[model samples]
Target: MGNEKDSLRAKLSPMSYHVTQENGTEPPFRNEYWDEERDGIYVDVISGKPLFSSLDKYDAGCGWPSFTKPIELEEIEELEDRSHLMVRTEVRSKKGEAHLGHVFNDGPKEAGGLRYCINSAALKFVSIEELEKEGYGQYKKLFS
Candidate 1:
């Protein structure tokens, strides 16, 4: 386990390692993918598991990448978080066990009224053009 973790730590950037492994949070509006506007999908940085779709992404004004939904509900695992003197639902990647961020009831009502506020450091964006090459061809139809 130590060797695997060490290898993973070496593979990820300091911010990514901190967010996904140590459950750290990145500064809002200063992190990557916060304002990304493209047709693609996001996968877990640690395990490369499918997570969120760009089509569901929106600017929640929280300075993070917010999505109306995940690419697959089964891909995410939500837990009750009681930290920082508050109660919240923390979202994590099922496969990687990476700390994604949090979810809230405040979102576009028409979109199920849920907001998945995710950390950019925990995700790796796979653009539409690279979906097939990246072994995620099934998701290319999302852009069409």
Candidate 2:
């Protein structure tokens, strides 16, 4: 595997580091902002590329985390995952290249029936309060 840990640390916070770097999962239902109803973007832990938005978020009760769609389709890289004797779509960050999680076809009808079951470790939420400060001011209209 490529050693992208150093680069990931520079872009993300310690908590994010623990998850992405150490492959740790944030406690279920106890994440810092898992229930955040704010309108904003969620980016990759390493490359800071936008992945998903609050608008596509839904409660899947799968434990880790889930999103309906990516903020930008090209920002994610999907690969055929056959790790556990099962065929699955493995989701990864296009830039950070970290393994985010899997994609499922069982989602709400309103969301095209696709669910991006992600790992909280692989994401960093950009709230409205920090969007402008984090160099993502251009996306402010997403909330407006």
Query: Which number leads on lDDT?
Result: 1
List residue ranges in candidate 1 displaced over 4 A: none
Q: For model 2, how does the per-residue alpha-carbon lDDT over 1-144 read when each residue is reduced to its tens digit?
A: 355556657767676777665544567776755566777888886788988888788888777567889988999989997776989898888787677778999989876999998877687888878999999998788777
Per-residue CA lDDT of model 1 for 10-123, tens digit only, reads 999999999999889999999989999988999999889999999999999999999999998999999999999999999999999899999999989999999999999999
Each model's lDDT comes to: 0.95, 0.79
Error of 2 at 135 (Å): 0.7
Q: Candidate 2 — which residues are off by over 4 angstroms?
A: 1-27, 30-33
Clash pairs (backbone) in predicted model 2: none
lDDT of 2: 0.79
